[model samples]
Target: MADTEVQFMDPLASHSVVPSGQQKQVRGEREPDRTESLQNTGQGEVEELLLSSSAVVAQAPPCGDRAACSCLGARWMERSLESMELQLQLLTSKADDLHNWVASGQDHFEREALAEAVSRFLYNCQPYFNHLEYLRSHKSQHTLLPLDSYTWLVDFSQQLCDRLEQLVLTYASYNLLCLDETKPNSVSPFCMGQSQLGPLRVAAFRYFKPMPYLAQVHTGLYKRMRWNVARLREEQREEGKNERVGDTEYYFLCYEDIPNADAGGDGNAVRTWSIGKWVQVTPGTDDIYDWIMCEVPQADYRRLLFLGSDEPSSSSATVRLQQMLSSHQTAE
Candidate 1:
């Protein structure tokens, strides 16, 4: 038998498309406007009627009894309800995406802009995590002590809970880089009282550059900490200081395991680290604030410790994540 060749439809057009299958629009479906022309017109516009040969609007068949009409009406209502439900579901999905976008700083702020600039990010989901708060922010050295620790503790907690929700920074899993003060920024550095501006007050300021490399985390189980020199601010409070020092001297927040750990490196999974001032340039203004160790805070460790201990305690292998950008907070 002679071989006959049949040309196949183009694959891009005929073979590949969504749903792995395609059906042409139902051929009998009447064009709305065109059908409007041929079907009926009760109004004023001058127009022509056009009708599709294959499509003729179907009318309800004549019914002899009232029961048939009622049944038909009910079926119509049910179909309309189903269609409305589908529309509502689509709208709901769009609304949810919008809400998440707003939380991610996408609605009012550009995504790249938000990522580039550092500011306080507030998360409403605070109650779920222990010692974490909604008011989380990236702080600078110009910030003071009390605010730094309080905010960092809370911010660290929020980030921990959001480990699963960090939509942007995806590579570093289960790793957090908290700001440790190689040299702590302190109030005492500017020892002189407010003098020049009405009294002997020194002006203070802080600066921070974007740190992308810090995101390269090595392990997934815990957070490791590193510190740089802490810079002092320019302002000198009215509060007098005992010593005279430069405005930007670096102070240190000394840390060891909390509850005083044994000399050996191996210890419990969740550990508490104590923070203390390495050096105190105390005058009217104290230079050093309380220390923050990589070890989990005392109260928070208790909280995480409570979780896996349902049966009056067995053991746990996970440690709480803690880290923050160095920010100088006001004494208050």
Candidate 2:
């Protein structure tokens, strides 16, 4: 497959290709339409939905120590929830808009434009998911920290959890649109597939471009992969410091087939890696100041990590698998 460029969706931008009249029609209110730009429409809807969603999150019972969780206060929770909820709203709205566009039917160019927009919108949500999981795990551990220091922790986590649920729903809707034959222009980076090795879902990582390698991994296999960490230290470099950073280790979450030992040893099996799980690997070190490591449980479908090279370099990533295979050879 050719390399695909990952586009970032600027929630704050006001650009939209939809005709002005259609934009007004979608808003459904006359009053001269305050949100003149489609970007604004997306941003505005996100803001409104996030506020409503945050209220729902706030009402839910608190998870960590309320005293230590400063962000959980009614007002602060609402404020902190803005960024995440806005992104979720923007993506979902984009999906909805694209669906309507397909339903209305359009020229080939218009369909291509809509497909690109959907791809970008869906890809951008991954980082927010990673950041949210990092926040949740850290806040849960810092129950002793004073509220003033991390005022937004509790609220951030709560709103993140809520928005994540919304993301799953929105992703499903978007995927369906891709699969819908009626919407001749629908497209996505992922597809549903199953085989004897087990069900496997794949996503291409733009940062690790052109990683054209493939292998079948069996279940119960543990492997560690390493990749060079990119760093920018102009100030340190100016002061005679080396800017190069060493590679770090992260475990790969591979999908394996599980035999149906429960079915009277019939030898039937199923794959266990749940879809829609958050799956990015990040390694933090004492040298890195802003790094956030996540400790979310791997067992939950929501916490599931994705396999996309799972590291920066394709060749280096295969080292662990090589070791596993070599060991197996010796044992045999």
Candidate 3:
């Protein structure tokens, strides 16, 4: 495939195309605009809030005794909670704005604006997760930290995941629309299977350039949250706790062509959509960051569809077969 250029124009400047392959080389040129966007949107506000919260935690009355330490921890928890609530309010407003923009009729320029908005929101969410992880790590020190705070954090993380999923679906929908708009009348190699292309395939083709970057950002956020949740689950299991602390599930839509399950003479490839759930099998190992998407059962897929969900599920048999084939590939 030919290289695609993703260009974002400043309202004050002329049109310029930034080649995706050469983005790093042109980073300096793009930095100014990104910095400007951050400033306009109050980008570092979350980090500032978190820093102030940490300051409060640090300035807690000297822990000269057990009672004093406990009191200090209680103060820290209260300050952290207050800071998190304020950060959540800020993020929720940004999320709402992004949703409104997506709902409205957007042209190319508006689409760029949407992408910028998403990038900014994701940037803010990163620090929020980091702060949450920090708090989790120090849970032992802060005896006053309520169990309910952990639950609230998990729910809030899932809420952010929901928003990211919506963004993915919106981009995929636009990709499909772009494909239709750019389709050719001639039956060339590039156009042969255009109509049959799924959202994943369309995204792979970079039909809409921002789709790939945004999808990647979405994946990174999901992986970080999943990793944290996996650790929580492991701790619960080790302690023999029946009540699960953070039970969060994330899935991505996938499409594949597979042979018919029915007994037939000429087996043909049938196009199907499937949901692949993201799993972090090794939380503390060298591969801790290596997350995989395992195909879910057909029943779950049907249930999701019945519930009016945008993502479709995958065929487990097909996915397994693909994995087996992949395992045998020779290393370069």
Number of the predicted model whose lDDT against the real structure is largest: 3
lDDT over C-alpha atoms for residue 19 of model 2: 24
For each candidate, give its TM-score against the true structure. Answer: 0.19, 0.37, 0.43
Tens digits of lDDT, candidate 1, 182-299: 2222111110001121222221111121121112232112111111222223443334332343432221121122332454656543343221111222222322332222221111
Each prediction's RMSD to truth: 28.4, 15.1, 15.9
lDDT of 3: 0.39
Query: C-alpha displacement of 223 in model 3, angstroms?
Result: 10
TM-score of candidate 3 on Cα atoms, chains taken together = 0.43
Model 3 agreement with the true structure over 90-149: per-residue lDDT tens digits: 767766766666678676655555555554454345445545434544554456657676
Q: Per-residue lDDT for 208 in model 3?
A: 16
Off by over 4 Å in 3: 1-44, 60-64, 176-332
Residue 251 CA displacement from its true place in model 2, Å: 3.3
The predicted structure with the larger lDDT, 2 or 3, is 3
Q: After superposition, how far is residue 291 of candidate 2 from its true place, in Å?
A: 28
lDDT for each residue of candidate 2 in 1-332, tens digit (9 for 90 to 100): 01122232222333233322122122234323322332233444543544454454445335566663544543444443455556555655655665566456565444444444444343334444433333333334455544442434334433433343343334345342343212333332221110010111112221111111111222253222111212324554356343333322122323445677788888777654311222232323233332433322122113234444223232222323333434544776
